[model samples]
Target: MTTSPAPAAPAGPDLTDEQWTTLVRARATDPQAVAKAYAARTRPAPLLSQKDTLFLVAADHPARGALRSGPDPMAMADRRSLLARMVTALDNPEVDGVLGTPDVIEELLLLGALEGKVVIGSMNRGGLDGATWTMDDRFTGYDAASIATNGLEGGKMLLRIDDRDAATAGTIEACADAVTELATHGLMAMVEPLPYHREDDGSLTLLKDTPSLARAVTIASGLGTTSAYTWLKMPSCDDPETVFGATTLPCVVLGGVPSPDPAQDLDSWGRALVQATVRGLVVGRALLYPPDGDVASAVEAAAVVLRAAHAGEDAA
Candidate 1:
């Protein structure tokens, strides 16, 4: 497939080196700066608008050791560069919020880039990419109490169910516990449940078929004591309407690994957003590190998709 021409790199953050040095110094001197920043930060008025569509930039992949974006394996390995791209993506007015692990979220908080944004904490990341125990995702990150105490909007967890893998049961139980806990705190519990099959080599492969996705959705929606505050972060499937028909809970489509063709990837997301239950998008590498390497343009393109979806809804 012919790739689109790479756009010129947009101007990065000004004085980023100096600012990073200062941030490092502060982290070294006072570990309390993260809490202070969170306390002092201004939050968005409402988590979702009247249309109920949210376009969130996700930065939680690195926590799972999945940092490859498009070609470069270590593309997101650079802390400073990743933050610079994230800040650029968040600079867009149409962008709603961010979903990240504690470290990335706290760094953005310190950089003051998360002000007036809906912040969602990543809960499970123990299933390191390519690890033998990859199916055993654990809740090693932010919990309900910490997310609420930090003034975050919600917590997200990954639940990969592989019937062949006994470890999957533990992940499900842990995620259910997290969901109940977050709901008790009146915070959103965004669960990403994907069905998988364990190969003979013990490696896991996600089953992207419609039936698999629907089954996973059914299982995830029923997790926790209550489904009131539960939301789903799902992939843009070929038949989203059928897959999403399994649950009434609100969902945000995730931008999985970057597609070689960026336009085709955006088109898929746009189509999924046409489903009423699909509230918005939670994209990461695709928007932050596009094949064109233009974070701003990639973000703008995603915003355009959401806007068009909203316009269609209003016309109906």
Candidate 2:
């Protein structure tokens, strides 16, 4: 991969000799280390890249405290190991960009992993994984101005509303404003909408019916000041046809909690991306942190699914 131009050093007082050495060490592989030092010196890094779009895996699992997988799952809580896997994945030609929080993005920026590549920053992390607030999603990552300044290509926020819980209103209002702001800055804002409900046992869940998904999509599409820059991040539900009727906006299926049958999950997503308004897939745990340890194969398989959809669009 060709290296994109490094961001100009943040303008400020000169770096001390020790700091300069630290930066040199940071440039080796740790993008976050470099970003932190640059921040300490008040010098933000430059844009990594702005080209291509395929499957950009989301790797923000740590914040949710879901370190383990099914029975044998791990905390996956180690930043360094996470970085290593991400860096390796980013180098793959089939993969385009990454969807993650500021820490991971900055690390990629520092390691030069994002040079001449798409960089999409995750916006809402406040929901935390599996927390009571999981459905109330909030914006805690790069904002509109940050996306523009950081040279990021786009921004994404989750909008999982559980109106029964009374927090859905806030999530809706926040998403509306976020959509407008992102559009005003000419940034692509991907809104992942889910009509969710918490069981009596308190498990956050997605509604499986067509009307529920349809109503949820309608509510989401109508958010913000305009739908021009907005795109839908939907689930691969049983009724893509019914769900597809909910909006004309471009959509992409999401990889929700990994299912016991991953092949079935990918097949479902592949079908939706092909038949409906889906433009692509925004897969997370299912593709990046899979049950098996083979990330490269999983990503390649996803790309095939995406390619088939794109080819179908071309044919039509």
Candidate 3:
């Protein structure tokens, strides 16, 4: 949003002059173009491109006030730079799809970056970053109906449980209702259940330990009337086997905090992908704003890891 000098974002896939003009024009005039674009866009079939695995780029963070990537506090504050990196990631042939909120997705739709890609709408982003009531991640984005009506393959909701917070209960309930609603439309309900512990000082921390993660997985696995159309979006951890052993639902590992070592991060994902239920990666900043500022290269590396994991699975 700012025009000031900020940290460099990933390079290439920059928007053309025409592309920028088209989006600006649409925003100023043609409001109905978004719906028309969705109706006419080619949809993906069989969802999973690699039979069992997928690799999806994610850009829904900005909506939730999560604009930081690495050391830069406002690294994702510039819409053009952020969207350009997203375009770069989606340009990779091996990338299966993308996950985003309405505004970002609408822009990409107008830019023609989402056609034939698996589009997942982010549902809850009401919990602002560092807010006191952050645990109340109310549904403020795409609801189940809107996601289906817009032709998205699924809807995603973030469920962070801080045991001490009462608001966590409402978030859990809302996510359950959303899962049921999405199931009625034959759409995927991708629930990201994260365990958090509110410190005495009021700071929150993600509990990525094996037991904490496994507990969160089981709790998410039972939402709604049925688990038939549900999938878990979980974080990868050491001893992934034990961490993910509690769920039979298909799972995808999300790229959480960006690490300085890309190869080390890939190795962590590769280990998680070994689990039969772990299908693929749904990564954002770790790929979009890599340390080297190469979006395509980061995406390609993720794809390679995904392919290798499935190949190893088949061989075994």
Cα displacement (Å) at residue 84, model 2: 2.5
Please give the range of 10 consecutive residues that has the lowest summed lDDT in model 1. Answer: 6-15
Model 3: per-residue Cα lDDT over 99-185, one tens digit each = 999999999998899878999999999999878877889999999999889899999999999999998999999999999999999
Between prediction 1 and prediction 2, which has the larger TM-score? 1
lDDT of 3 at 283: 98
Over all chains combined, what TM-score does candidate 1 have? 0.94
Best by lDDT: 3
Better model by lDDT: candidate 2 vs candidate 3: 3
Off by over 4 Å in 3: 1-13
lDDT, candidate 2, 1-316, per-residue tens: 9966533211212324554455457767565564453233222132221212346677766655566543334525545545656766666766667777777776556655665556677887788776656765777777888876766767888888786788878888898998999899887788888887778899866787888899888998999999898888888888788897688887878887777677988889877876556667777767655556566677788878778767745666
Expressed as tens digits, the lDDT of each residue in 1-316 for candidate 1 is 9986643333343326777998788889989998899899898888896677888999999999997776677777878888988899989988988999999998888888998999999999999998887777988889999998989999999999999977788999999999999999999999999999888977667898999999999999999999999999899989988998888999999999878888998899988888878899999988888776778888999999888977977777
Global lDDT for candidate 2?
0.70
Task: Give candidate 2 misplaced runs (Cα > 4 Å).
Answer: 1-53
